[model samples]
Target: MDSVSEAQFELDQLRHQARKQLLGTVVLGVMAGLLAFVGQSALGQARPLLESSFGTWQSLYTVVLWALAIAWLVALIQQALHYQNISEQFESRRRLDAVYAERAAKAQAVEEERQRQRAESEARQAAERNRRLNKNSHSTKFDFWQE
Candidate 1:
């Protein structure tokens, strides 16, 4: 509705988004680690099975291992980049929140000053009215005696 509420709502949304991004990054990292471990285990088990054949099979097995290693490296790099992006997003949100807080504080201070000035103006007006009333009443009393 108002600017303050709107700012607060936006800040909340940013926080939610940042949390979600963090969770996603963690999940990605875990998945990458699992993939590497599983791939390594599978290759280790397969090596003995092909050992009897040797020669050509050994070359193929080496190629397969290298490919898997490369894939794992790529996955790790991708996850790291995703995490970096998320970190940047968090930083941006933090800066935005700081700006919002500063603006809110300034707005509150301005509103308080405005209220104080208004109260002082009202007090001055009330005092002026009372002074005029007293002067008129004293003059009227003298007039009553003359009549």
Candidate 2:
């Protein structure tokens, strides 16, 4: 379509993309939290079963838990960074949209002012024409009366 419509479409797309990114970041964060919780719960439950098998399984379990915790922390940090990036993008888009809206408002105001001036000019012209017509008619009537 027109440039205005295209710009609007692009703005809408940006908004949608930002929203999706935010949602994905939230989902990732939630998943990471859930994973940590579940891991802890499972480890606690399995501790009883491993009591008899102690040493070997205990070391393995500790290593595994530490690895998972490290991984979860990393993932959480990554997701937080991604969310911040999305927020920055969203803010940028909003600023752009605000600029566009301000420009549009100024353009509309200029157009309206021009239209008002044009209408006033036309009215003045019409009034001047009417005055001239009245003067001519009065002159003709006076000449006829003198005859």
Against the reference, the lDDT scores of all candidates come to 0.71, 0.73
- Candidate 2 lDDT score relative to the true structure: 0.73
Worst 10 residues of 2 by lDDT: 2-11
RMSD of each: 5.1, 5.0
lDDT of 1 by residue, 1-147 (tens): 656556556666666666666667667657766776686667667777867665576567567767866766676566666666666666666677788889989999999999999999999999999999987777654686787
Residue 130 error for model 1, in Å? Answer: 1.0
Question: Tens-digit lDDT track for model 2 on 48-109?
Answer: 78777756775776687678668766766766676566666656766777788899899999
Find the candidate with the highest lDDT and give its number: 2
RMSD of 2: 5.0
- Report the number of the highest-TM-score candidate: 1
